[model samples]
Target chain A: MLHVTTGAASGPGREPILSLRSAVFGYADRAVVADVTLDVRQGEVVALLGPNGSGKSTLVKGLLGLNSHLGGEVELFGTPMRQFRDFTRLGYVPQRHTLSASVRATVTEIVAIGRLPHQSWWGRPGRTDQRLIDRALDLVGLEDRAREDVSTLSGGQQRRVLIARALAAEPDVLIMDEPTAGVDAASQQVLAEVLARLAAQGTTMLIVTHELEALRDIVSRIVLVGEGHLRFDGTPADFVLAQRRQQDLILAHEHHHHDDDSDVSQAPGVLSTPHGPLEQPAQKRGVES
Target chain B: MNTLTTLTTLGGLPELLDYDFMRRALLAALLVGIAAPMVGVFLVQRRLSLIGDGMGHVALAGVAVGVFTDTAPVLTALVAAVLAAVLIELIRARGRTSGDVALAVMFYGGIALGVVIISKSTSSTPANLTAYLFGAITTTSNGDLWVFAVLAVVVVATTWLLRPRFFAVANDEEYARATGMHVTALNLVLAILTAVTVVVSMRIVGLLLISALMIVPNAAAQLLAGSFRTAIRYAVAIGVISSVGGVTGSFYAETPSGGTIVIVAIGIFLLASIGTSVRARVVSRRHQRAEHHPHEHGLGCGHPAVAHGDHVDYLHDGHRHAPHAGHYDEHDPRVHAQTADESETAAETTAETRSS
Candidate 1:
């Protein structure tokens, strides 16, 4: 058996691609995202979903090893995340809001940052690197725009360039944060196709977003995050089951109240719903707000 | 003109080479030229430029105390400046007040301490100690020159050896910490670098305007260059030009070398800023033309270097809010004008995913 030790951690032949245990995000002393345990297995497509300020972004950053605070342990390839320097191996398509817009780099140039760890600092990319970039661009269907200045591209196209950047690294796992935001329909379709293809090829991916319905086709599992905590984790079918159960409960309660109110209206003294017969959904006609 | 040239800026150069005063001035200025901007890059990026000014003032108090006690001024000043800088860093690390607020506190406190010491002293010459406040390049000594050379070498060596680490610190401190970087050590190093730069530049840019040398050339460089290396190149070039030109101007015009250096630097900055604006306009026009077709992503900068909404710049007013309130991150719908499906796709992604 081949044995190896990776940066302050030990692992067997097969170790987790990524893991987070009791991670917390904070500013100074106050925790913003607290005590989260999560893991992503190879070839799995998991989506982090939440409302505004629900810690999805923090969790993503933490998983990427970009967030500073973690309460317990975070690991990549069984190595302590804080000690890992090979960020390229963990292909991250960062939020569009984070990239510096003033850089005059081309689309190919942006993609090439994905190769930073593989090359020495002083060495410029050569033909082999260019070939990799070209292949990555081809994968994203943006081969024609490889050399074009990235700033001149449409919003949808820019998003493609970022994804292409991530793809260039050929990582076993990909984490895309809000990749579909501000993208066009055609571009979204292309992105979905590419990710679906990547999944078929057996690359693990974790995509975090506020909305998940559009990704239903590609994502195998759903993880709900709120208030810095993971509230749900399972297949999309389980999520659908939960949603349906909630709706059924609401409907049954409403029907029972209506029957009580009708009976009371007719019998004069039958006014009983325990707390007064769920009165007509109690919704004001013109004052719903 | 000859006398002024001889004693004004490079005022002491001949004597410095042949005598002590000129040597101190020459060595000190040379040390300043290299160290200030090199270390200043970290300070400016961290938005702690005023911290340099505060440290310089803190050193001034140390000089005053040295004068009163008849002690070696440079040693006393270094001790005081470094201590004051450490205190400022501690206050800043607490993350309670803005860096400038901490700087202001350290600034007044250092100066007051120095004044009180100076007032009580009888043996020291008030004029000699006072000159260190604004700096007197004319009175630089042989011993000071050697001290400067050693300090300069150390500053350069440390900066070069720690480039990647400092860059990580300056770029994002939080990220630096997460990546297992010794962020605390690096931050301490950065503060020390600022202290060293201030001590050296006091003879050239003056304690009153030392931050200008650190701030102006870099700001001008930022306006002109799109990358970190280019920005530093532009900044150093501006620094060199201002140093050479300011020395010449002060020699002929009979002004203080420190003041003249700052003036020349500001002139260069204004010129670069003007160039940046004109270039921005032209670039925007070209961007509009390219993007007008509606099929391209145009240029990243063609959209203007606006973050959230207002431009990515800070002011001296102490507030960090942007000028564009609601417009920040407000994308123009027509810019990409996507189909309902695409819009719904992301909206669906945001709405439907409750777990991941």
Candidate 2:
């Protein structure tokens, strides 16, 4: 058994950056994710993992107020979600497909958009804003391509540009939805390095991903969801151990089924290796996931 | 023929400027040229290129209302267009009706109502509606010119001041919302700006063809500009040239101002398209020709060597050059995927012969 703490036990008096209590998230009262209790403290990197149709994405959207809050309490930076207005403190990196392909904006122009939250309606970018934008482009290693049109870039480079846009805001907590999805392997490695560097800087991040391979080392905790409920919440090592045990149980049950049935080949096929039933649904929504 | 002879025999531009109506027409055209594309770039970015046409139809209804109530046509048109702009934005924001469908309904209903109302008005004539449908810039009064000036200033100043915010919403509304921007408000502001642009341009470019002045120059500018800022600059320049040139051409040819303006804008667009294609071909041909370099690039050639797929390329000057069988082959990463590999040997032979 693992001790599932509401928030990370890094220090005694540290407050949770994001807290949800029995949160029910959905669209128009049709709940997709229900009875979810989670808390993220300062400087903790948490990965929200779930299969397709498990409502992980809906939950993240709920936290951002994109989805309907069916019931329960959600808080950000110790304030209630309804009363919380300091949105600049939170940076969101949506999926790369969210960017419209028709826009003819330069890399610098896109990155400068992240500074809008800090700027007044009629104000231009000051020296500090320019420095931050430059630093963000530098962080993504895209300073050289700052003047090029974003549509001319490859898919992975465009993802990096999105990340640079989010980082330019200097948010206290960064929330990314599948930052490595649909990216090539080399770009995935680069994205992982960027996240690792951000983690080293003590930036709190809640990354929603189904696969943990790219962000395995950077993720401090793992929260697994299945069928719209929190199935497991623990350290990464404990989660791995739990996954292994579940795999062993499936394999042992398949062995018994093999003996009982004349169709032995079908028994092994029932138990998919490595991921088993928990990770199978991820491939169901291939276009989106 | 007579106007053409006068244009040739006299100093045409200076002589034409001597008339009061000509001065008003030129000023109105200049303002429309400057303001239309300034608002049009964002409309094009949002893919609402036809929204200008819809708004133009609505402004025609406003003109009918002015004729029916015996009021200034420009004022009533501005009022009607602004209301319709807000209504369309609200319907779009509610998400119940799709945007293009709403715009279509507005377009047909507006023109139908405009024609019906104008036909019933006692002061209306078919010629008055014709003048609005196709512009009669040479008939613009000083009062109409003053109204155009005010509306043009409002459109230009608002689009310039709120360009970044407008771009953010137009590029990606969800992303702008995530950044804590007031997207709904910005969208309404954009819609109102579009309405103002439509009204400002209706007298010079005509309500029927105002969208052309708003969109064609932008389309032409995008072919050559590498950035959005540069595109806006180029689009405004094209808009100014097309409108002024069209007005001058109409004076010489005895044509309607709106048709002449749209044709001039289309001419510029065709030129830009052909120029872009020719420039691309020229760049590729240049890249195909390899310069003669006596210094061989290798492991210790003092130049940085980058590992390409299965081969090494040496960075020289600004581009990379890979050593082939006997000569250096220039490797442009930008067009690497498009250029065929079989032509390398033939180009190398050409380079060798030229060097010899």
Candidate maximizing DockQ: 2
Q: B1-356 in candidate 2: lDDT tens per residue? A: 32443354266878778888888998999999999998999989988888889889999999998999999999999998999999989988887747668778888899999999999999989988988998987669899888889989988998999999998888878778876789999999999999998988888888999999999999999997988999999999999988887887788778889988898889889999999999877655755444765554545457787665545666677666764433456777545434445434222222221331
Q: How good is the docking of model 1, as DockQ? A: 0.08
In angstroms, give how far residue A187 of model 1 lies from its true place.
Answer: 7.8
Per-candidate local distance difference test: 0.62, 0.79
Q: Per-candidate TM vs. native?
A: 0.69, 0.83
Every candidate's DockQ is 0.08, 0.29
Best by lDDT: 2
User: Which residue window of length 10 is worst by lDDT in model 1 chain B?
Assistant: B347-356
For model 2 chain A, where is the 10-residue window of minimal lDDT?
A280-289
Clashes of 2: 0
Window of ten residues with lowest summed lDDT in model 2 chain B:
B345-354
